[model samples]
Target: MLDDITGKVMVLENHNGQQLEQQPQQQQALQTPKSGVRRSTRISRPLERYSPSLYYLLLTDSGEPECYEEAVQVETRKKWEQAMKEEMDSLAHNQTWDLVRFPAGKTTLQNKCVYRLKEEYGGRKRYKARLVVKGFAQKKG
Candidate 1:
């Protein structure tokens, strides 16, 4: 018997000391998609472009060439949730914003630092930024 198990060696019994022969006509056909419509297949590799047109652009600042080579900037992606949570925790621990019901016709009488936090709604967190006033300042105007 022919085995296709990975990383393991098979021990075969050679009774009568005969060699095994494989027949090509006993092969099974691979399964294919239905003939009526074409099923889409996702491409699994990067695209390659060849023989493309090349143009040299000379970037100058008021008749002076900045450099002979072009500048390149590469950016990597990041997860903002962890950083945002840390910032929110620091703001809350420092008592940056006090949750209170301020009476109508009354405004904060102090210089403040704006604090922000994220609130989740409908499977997404909406950020709420608030201006927190200092307690030691008198109202102006």
Candidate 2:
């Protein structure tokens, strides 16, 4: 029945007439011609200049508050306050710090609230506020 088959057929056998499994053929690597010339696949085109108005339309400023006083004075003051409250609640829930008295002769570090406008899916904006300590003020012990 095997003799009726056409094309190249690999056959492996042992002394006991048991057929051995054949390994798969390895693929050949693509080789360039002897001239060593490589064909350019990309087409070169003239660069198009864009107008400044297009950039202004695409990249709108976030207009987030830079400081706490500015945050409270902005039109989105309620949103910024809510965000700050949420941040404080999260820090308290995580037990990030404990209330303690200031150490004598030790300078206290200053903290500031940073605000940002986070854009969500479908053009929705979310207010985000983070409390950051001024670590640079700390002196090396």
Candidate 3:
């Protein structure tokens, strides 16, 4: 499916897996505007050039880092570390937790860092690293 200014273009397949093209936009009849309603028309503007890199980036999946050491590049690793530090700073500012002595029989659960590549509404790529508790070990309150 592809979306153009006219409308969405849908491709269909037959029982035998033969591809079929839907009727062209020109053949579709136009509907008359309703009575007592004013329709606003938009001025046509030049189309923007398509970016192949942006298209490929959007289509491909960027996998998360399995471990802290899994970050391949120095810059990527730095970004992860910066994200972690920012999170820690926020947690500290909010007083999310307090440092305390560990109970003798209890074990402290270790946290894991997860990486996600996000695209902003303005088409900017963001590298986000989130720290998550290994919650499988946590019991119901």
Candidate 4:
């Protein structure tokens, strides 16, 4: 069954795969008035919507490989290599970092390439690669 509340349709299914009807309170709210004009539970006002960058925090992709080795094991090694090369080229073009000699008693941060498949709704998939510094390795200043 489909319930329309606040102009949004919500479809709920029971454990037995049967659609569930709306609760009595929801039904009463949807009841029409005796007046000539019908009352609607549907919301006519515009809603406030926002897409935050932290949306990824709520999602976890089990299919995604965690590390470069795992990525190579799952996806085509050639594709990962091409993606890495592209990322490196972009970093170089942007001059993202510079090589420097490590000071004595100071630790140098390690870096790794993170690879993932990015896909848009009804759009083509893309292989993305990014180099991330191991920030935890940095010494407290």
Question: Best candidate per TM-score, number?
Answer: 2
**Model 4 regions more than 4 Å off:** 1-62
Per-candidate TM-score against the hidden true structure: 0.22, 0.56, 0.49, 0.49
24-137 per-residue lDDT for model 1 (tens digits): 357688888677767669776644432232212222222221221211111111223333355568888999778999999887666432323345776664433243446667
Residue range 16-113, candidate 2, lDDT tens digits: 99998766657699897678668998997645447676656554455787789888988889999999999999999999999999898988889999
C-alpha lDDT of candidate 4 relative to the true structure: 0.74
lDDT of 3 by residue, 47-99 (tens): 54466776566544455566677655545777677776887788889998999
In model 1, state the lDDT of residue 117: 30
- In model 2, the Cα lDDT at residue 140 comes to 91
lDDT minimum window of 10 residues, candidate 3:
55-64
Angstrom error at residue 59, model 4? 13
Please identify model 3 stretches exceeding 4 Å from their true place: 1-63, 72-75, 139-141
Model 4, residue pairs in steric clash: none
Candidate 4 lands at a TM-score of: 0.49
Per-residue CA lDDT of candidate 4, range 1-141, in tens? Answer: 334566667888889998888665643466665767668988776443434434454333445556887767764677777888999999999999898887898667799987788887889777888999999878777
The TM-score between candidate 3 and the true structure equals 0.49
User: Which regions in candidate 1 have their CA more than 4 angstroms from the true location?
Assistant: 1-78, 107-141
* Count of clashes, each model: 0, 0, 0, 0
